[model samples]
Target: ALVLEMKSLLGALGSSWALAFLCSTRWDWLRHSVLCTGRWHQVRRSVISFRRSWPGKIIMKGSSREWSGTMGQHNMLRFRAGQVDPMSRRLGNLLNMLMLGGQWDRRYYSCTVVVPENVMKDAQRVGRWVSRDDINTMGLLRHNWGESALADRYYPGLYKKLEEYHGVDFHESVMCWHIATDLILAKEEKEKEDFAADKRVQTVRALSNYMMFLLVNRPYMLPGLPQNWLYKQTCNNLDKICNDYDLVGSLGDSLWTVLKKLLGLHHHRVLESSGLEKKLADLIMKLPKEHASSFSETPRLLYARSVAVIILESGVVDKVRLLLDLWMDFLAYAANRCIRESHAQKLSTGGELVTIVWLILEHLRYLKEDPNQQHGHV
Candidate 1:
C-alpha cells in the first residue's frame, strides 16, 4: 500500500527530470535531474494549493448570475427542492427569515408564534412547529366559517373592514411582493452591489413574494378575501413612489426602509414635484363614490404601514433581524393556511410560495397542525 501510494504521488509530478533521474548513472546528470524533479513537484503542489485557497474559484455561480427579479415559479420550485440553498443567498436567507421569524432576535424585537390562549392551553406537542391542539387555528376557522372568529378580537378595524369588504388584511404581503420584485430589478440593473447580502432587502423580498403568492393563488384559504387585486395595485403604487423620486434603481437595502416607504414625507416633495397626488385624486374621483372612498387614501403608504408594523418593534434604529423574523412569521401563517390540494394546483401552474415555506416549517419542526384541517382537506 505504501509503495503504491508513493508511486502515485510521484506519478502526479509533471516532469521528465524525475524520469531521467531514476534511470541515469552519470553523477552530474543524476544531481541535475534530482534537483529539477524536486522543483517540479514543489511547483505542482503550489499551483494545486493556490487553486484550493482561491475564493474567486469557489464563489457559488448562482450568486454571480443575475437574480430573477420575478422570483419565478420555477425558481420557487428549485429553492424549495434545496438545490439552490447553498448557492443562493437571496433565497436561503429569505427561507431562514420565514423559518426563524419570531425566534430570531434583533435585540429590540423578537418574532412570536401565537396560538389562541385557549388552544395553547389544551395543546399537546405533535409536529415540531405544530401541536395536536392547534388544529382549529386562525386560517382554517376563517376558511370553514368564511371569516376568522379571532380576527375581530385581534384586529378589530381590519376585521370590521374585512367583514364589510369580505376579505383579509394581506395588503402587506402583496406590498412586500412588490418591494421584492423591485429589489430584484434594482439588483439586476446594478442598483446595489450588496443587494444580495442585505438581509433587510431579502426580508421584504421574501415576505412580499410569499404573501403575494397567497393573495394571488390561495385566495380561498385567505378566507376568500375580496380585495380587488389590492396587492397588485399597491405594487404599482410602490414602484411609482420610488420612480417618482428616481429611487427605483436606488431602493436602499437598509433597516428603516419601511419607514421611508410608509412615511408620506419621504415622497412629499416627489409627489408635489410630479403632481402625482392630484393625478391620483383625479383617478380616484372617477371611481364610484363607495369604491373610491375605500380605495387607498394614501397610495404612497398603502402597504408601508404593514411593513412598518412588522418591523416596528425591531429597534429599527439598530437591527433588521427582528423585523425580518416578524415578517417571516407573518408569512408562515399564510403558508400554513392551505390544504394539500390547493398547494398542488397552484404549484402546478407557477408554484406557490406558501408550499415552500410550509415544507420548511414542517422540516424544521415548527409546524402546528391546523385543527380545522380535516374539514378543509380534499
Candidate 2:
C-alpha cells in the first residue's frame, strides 16, 4: 500500500511530459528513487549528486527534496502512532507545512503559533536565516520595497506563537523605522537633516517617550556618561525653545523658574552656602524605607557623594551646588542600597554612577569659568 501511494505521488509530480521524459533514464531512476523514499539522509545525498551534475537544477530539486523529507517523516510518525510524542508530531507537521510553502496560507495557522518544545531546536535553526542585519540590508535596497521575501515567508501568522510567548510585538512601526535609521546612518554623510525633516515631531516625541521609559523602567541601562542620545536630545529641545522664542526675557525667565521648581530648588538660590550633609540627611529621611534601601545599595550614591564633596570643597553655595547636592544624595542612597544587597554586584552601575558624576562636575566647571571672564574684564 505504501509503495502504491509512493508511485501515485511520483506520477503526480511527473505530470509534465518533459519532467517524466527526464526521469526515465537509469541514472534518473536511481536518483528519483532515492528522493522518493522521503528520508532526509537519502534526499540530502540525492540533492548533492544532482548539484554536482546539474547545478542549475539544484534549487528547484533541493526545495522538493526538503519538502519530501519533512512530509515523509511526518507520515512515518503518523503511521507509527505511539512512536512519536504529541509535541514531536506537532513539530513534524509544522515543519512539513513550512517546507511545502504553507507560510502564505493564513487558514493553515493563526498569527500566533505556540511552538512545541520538541521543535524548539528546529525553530532556532530556521530563525538564523532571518536576522536584524539581513532585514536592515534588505530595507535599504530600493528595488526590493514591494514585498519582502523574508516577511512573506515567515511573518505575522508563521511565527505567531513564538511572538506571543516571547512578548514580541512584530507590528511596531517605530522598531522598523529604528532599524532603517541604523542602516541609513551607517553611510558617511550625516542623515540628521533627513531624519529631522521626515515627521520630525512624531519621531522626536517617540524617541523622547522611549528614552523616558528606559530611564524610568530600565534605569540600569543608562550609562554614567552625560554625552549620550538622551542628553543630546534634551539639549536640542532647549536650543529649539531658545531659538524659537524670546527665552531670556519673560518666557525664558518663566521657563528657568519652572525648571528650578521641578529640580526641587525653587526656594534655593543658585549661589547659597548651604550645608550639604544636612540637606542629604533630610532627603534620605524623606525617602520611603524601600526606596531608601535601594538608593543606598546603588553605586550612583558613591558618585553623588563625590560630587557633593567637590561642591563643598569649592566653598561655593550656588544654584548649581544645591542641585548637584540633591542629585548626588538621591544617587548615593540608591548606590548604598545596591552595595549592601547580596545579589546586586553589577559593575555597569558603578560605571554609570561615575559618568554622571563627571558630567555634573563638567557643568559646574563651565558655569564657574563663564562667570570668571566677566570678573576679569571688570
Winning candidate number (TM-score): 1
For model 2, state the Cα shift of residue 232 in Å.
2.6
Model 1: lDDT of residue 113: 18
Candidate 2, residues 1-378: lDDT per residue as tens digits? 785565445533433342454456568666565445544344345534544464223223332322111100001101122112343335446656778422211112111111223222222222122222322332221212112221325233322222222111211211222222222222211323443333322222223223222233334433232223432233233233233332222111244643333232322111111132122223322334454343343222222223333333433323222222222222222222222221122221223332332233223323333433322211
Taking all chains together, each candidate's TM-score versus the true structure is 0.34, 0.15
**Candidate 2: which stretches are off by over 4 Å?**
1-230, 237-378
Over 1-378, each residue of candidate 1 has an lDDT whose tens digit, in order, gives 785565345444533444465546468765565555676557555544543464322322122212212221111111122221233324335646788421211111111111223222111211322322433534231232212322344334443432322223554434443342332323232434653465454444444343444444345544335464454355345334333433312222244633332231122111011123222322322334344333365342323333333323323342233333334445455556556676665553334445555554444343335654323221
Residue 204 CA displacement from its true place in model 2, Å: 15
Clashes of each: 15, 32
What C-alpha lDDT does candidate 1 achieve relative to the native structure? Answer: 0.36
User: How many steric clashes does model 2 contain?
Assistant: 32
* TM match of model 1 to true structure: 0.34
Task: Give the distance in Å from residue 370's predicted Cα in candidate 2 to where it truly belongs.
Answer: 63
